[model samples]
Target: MDDQDILMVSEAQIAESFDADGLMLKPLTLFIKTEHPDVIERELSVLGFFSISTSTTPEKTPMYEFTLSPLNT
Candidate 1:
């Protein structure tokens, strides 16, 4: 995603969403908005890097939430 499509979520909000386990790294959640949600979804799905979920604002604006975590190899 480009800089324009990304919305920065606050550190406090991220901390609140996740539990702390000092030994482990935290997952990152990205909030992305785009005119073509389907295209973005398809692209991300092809990459197979993130766990994606979708939602829409009250005004029917599409938002994509992508969560990335360390993979256990």
Candidate 2:
């Protein structure tokens, strides 16, 4: 499969999703977003060595992000 497809499949496998009010993203989530931003940017951008996005709700504001690179990447 293409890289984008691979990324989508991988995210699906992990069942990762963020709530509008969530404060933190799990390590695995950050790692995946970091490693796959180029392939995944068609939908979202993973910034600051991890995927970062503003909350759709004004109350949520900025969201802190984190991630660890895969051993194989």
Candidate 3:
């Protein structure tokens, strides 16, 4: 994969909020430029993220949205 195909997540890119139940929620929005977005989705699932939605940018780049919460919550 070229450098442009690699997805990088910065600390500032991660957003945290609390649900109504006071559960901490981490939401992520990733615009995948790679041809195989499933690989990225699987990786995120391994990290405990739940797939929220999947879409595409105006340019047709795959876009994935995910959310993660504490296992206890």
Maximum-TM-score candidate:
3
Q: How does residue 38 of candidate 3 score in lDDT?
A: 66
Evaluate all candidate structures by whole-model CA lDDT and list the values in order: 0.60, 0.34, 0.53
Candidate 3: regions farther than 4 A off? 1-4, 8-26, 60-73
Clashing pairs in 1: none
What order do candidates take by lDDT, descending? 1, 3, 2
lDDT of 1 by residue, 1-73 (tens): 3535656467875776455763224566666776776777788678765455665555554566655453431
Report residue 5 deviation for candidate 1 (angstroms). 4.1
Which ranges in model 1 have alpha carbons more than 4 Å from their true place? 1-26, 59-62, 68-73
Q: Please provide, for model 2 over 1-73, each residue's C-alpha lDDT reduced to its tens digit, 9 standing for 90 to 100.
A: 2332221125552445333553333435332323344444434443434443321223342222323323322
Q: Which residue pairs of candidate 2 clash?
A: 46-51
How well does each candidate superpose onto the true structure, as a TM-score?
0.46, 0.21, 0.47
TM-score-based ranking, best first? 3, 1, 2
Candidate with better lDDT, 1 vs 3: 1
Candidate 1 residue-pair clash tally: 0
